[model samples]
Target: MARNGRSERGATIIDVARRAGVSAMTVSRVINGRSSVRPETRAAVERAIEALAYTPNTAARSLVRSAELRIGIIYSNPSAAFMSEFLTGIYEEASSTGARLVLLKGEGGRPPAQAALKRFRKSALSGVILAPPLGETRSVLSAVRSWELPVAAIGAYDVDGVACVRIDDRSAAFEMTRHLLDLGHRKIGFVLGNPDQTASAERMAGFYAAIREVGGVEVKVAQGDFSYASGLVAGEQLLGGDERPTAIFASNDDMAAAIVSVAHRRHLDVPSELTVAGFDDTSAAVTLWPPLTTVHQPLRRLAAEALAAVTAAASAGSTVATCRAKILDHSIVKRESLAAPLGGADARSDPDA
Candidate 1:
């Protein structure tokens, strides 16, 4: 139907094929994202489609389809390993549902968050999922509200009304510490992450809880910012303290590796002289000499759960408010990094003695 001839509802693919001088089948292949269409042919098909204002027939197809897709993932992390792994979950989940992952970079602080949320509305993304600390923020939560977008926060700490897919951080930490205590590690030191981080706080509570359960064992807690340098700085002080712990539980593997490095420099033998453990069984945990005992979080699986939850929420036409928390299990991975303290005079003796 020509624009001048009649008031047609819309142009069809036949109109594009006629203008491009290609068979209707070739035009259909290009439009459907099928392979084997030549570059020149694809280009001509696109041009003719634009010229005729031809949109796809997905509307009719969608009526028969049982799925709604195009999921949006929001990450406030600096482009890094953790974020990359999180996105892998998003992609895998989206693929299973015949959807695409529309990732949003929310790296900057509050101002960036506002701008990112604003830009999010301009796109055709269906639902949004928040990762970690970002999901725990007041500003981000408020922004999510103002944007009128469906948002699910993965790894949320305080979820009064928020939807989250996270693990029991406090319980995980408690269990890991209890495992060490059961192995006869009484005088254990802790290298913690930033106080502002909810996981760090929860993990610290777990360590202290274990100490309280056994009664009378000293707890030396060092502050770290979840970085190698922070670990190095804090670890040195803890290692050189008057009552050095026989075993040190770092908040994460990176800091644990730093503790291991510091121990090596001081000529302290691992497991034989001192034992070290860490949380968040990151890659470095297994690579350290003798490796590290840590709590293994199902990062990828948790991520998939978060994405799937968001997908389900959007597909069900429910507000993100309707979504609830999901808890994943964690495991304790033991390697050579843990052992009974060296006997008597050689084992973690007091500096003042």
Candidate 2:
């Protein structure tokens, strides 16, 4: 039998709701045995489920409600905007799932990750989520493995025996660079993120790849640590030069916003005289004047997925046996911070027009 315009083999919650003539939430309530659902409605949902052969994703749904999960999150990220967004996502999921979260701030000069891990060792955490650049740190990953805890690393690439959730930083950077190139930017400045993180390298590689694809593009590179302070320094270095780039792409939003600040300080009109682009599409992107054009990295979703992965493994009393990398999608977000260079394409050809 047809299941609400879909094949009967893999019916979803929506299909069951359609068949029952009820909302998806009502169907969910019935499925989860919530007492608030009316008996008549519950009966309808069950009948629909049986008729459509709908099999709910019990693993995904039950893990949250079935048990209380104690999860530890270790972070020492420099970007406040990024950390804020990441924590918000984790809190949202934890609140819904009734999971208790232990936030450990990596502190002190002796490798902040190790400091946090030392604290974590004393806590009764069922699983741990390592936030970058901690996630990419070999020593930290090794320490977590030694603890025999189920682990999920956020924004780390190519590590063994851990679950990871991240966007394709390389592809996202490439797309952002292409966006600037398409906007008639031939001389572009790039602000690099923290050297410790793998994502920084990936983004740099992506920018260069795009530049190579379109020959004759002049590029300027500056160092940043994904922080406003680093951005300020980088911005000064890039904008201080005699020959300024028409467009600048910072590795993340915080730095991008800094670049904008530097431009303003230099009395350069944004978009008209300079176009600035950022990555991560963090809160900093929109909070600034002329909302930043950036690559939308799903920071919230990444955190949510990482939480889920670690929690699932913790609940199962096992570590993720092999590396399970869940790469999420990213998109290029266009905003007021970007525009065609002054004098347009003709400016590139004209020597003294």
Candidate 3:
């Protein structure tokens, strides 16, 4: 039974199905974590897999297939820092798997994404990966699904029939807010990301949740489109007022860096007169004078995971059926940008400090 020093008669999906007394499709559904499968059926499939030592041959299938694997990436995110890290992840993964990547800039609205999908329809693309904002766009998702292309979404949550990879934005934001609160910052300002993305809403929700947990805290909200320019405007609005916040948390590092710039212009010492925090530990977070205390969102890993999921689904020739959601981990990164307020826990009494 040995071939090339390995077992030639290795277990396959059919073998697992036969051992479990179920159809191959049922086994596949169980393997992909589809909710439609009954608990008993899922358990049986797991038991069969364990007993037979059956492993899905994604790599072998890809190698045997004649068509080259081409993956399309459509993105419209405004943050350059975020995109740089995201593309790095995708490139790294593609190089390892020998998958070709086709890039498309979806700057406008649904038209760009839809147009990209239309172009990909004729390009022999094996699958597509939609970056944030575009990933959450209903029109774009519907259009891609209509074309019957294997698709995965990055930074989007709970999209039916699509493989999704993201961190818990709400939870991450909540933890970051808690960190500021623990540092004795009572008056805090928040800079929001683009309104079109679901992550913006989730992050805002987390900020409010933490704020609600504490009483008598003053909070100011400003809008930013996750761009450095937008961050500058938001930072000005937040710091220009007479009753300024003791700390500010931006939705992303770009905005946080902008806030730092604004603070320096106003002669405020970071972590002394004012504390700043940001989400997504992108390049901007560390490059600034004082490193940002922020949420560590694995932008590159998210992109890589999404690409891998869609490519694997395409390899199996059942993208929609095999699509699954994966939630990655996020952590709070502590750095010099955050500290206790100037007057510590009693800073609120002065307000002008």
Model 2: per-residue lDDT, tens digit, 283-351?
999998889999999999889878866765554345552255788999999999999999887655323
Candidate 2 residue-wise lDDT at 343: 81
lDDT of 1 by residue, 1-353 (tens): 35653136566655666689764445656866867679999999999988888877676546424445666676664324356567777777667656667766654422246766778757776667777667777766777666555567777775655567677878888888887676666688898875665877888888887667775467788888777778898779888976788888888777888899999999899987788988777677877797998888877877877665555445434455334456788888988999877664343233222
Mark the 10 consecutive residues where model 2 has the least summed lDDT.
315-324
**Which is better, 1 or 2, measured by TM-score?**
2
lDDT minimum window of 10 residues, candidate 1: 344-353
Error of 3 at 45 (Å): 9.0
Score candidate 3 by TM-score against the native.
0.82
| Each prediction's number of clashing residue pairs | 0, 0, 0
TM-score of each: 0.73, 0.80, 0.82
Local distance difference test, each candidate: 0.71, 0.82, 0.83
Q: What is the lDDT of candidate 2?
A: 0.82
Task: Name every residue pair that clashes in candidate 1.
Answer: none
Q: Residue 320's C-alpha lDDT in candidate 2?
A: 56
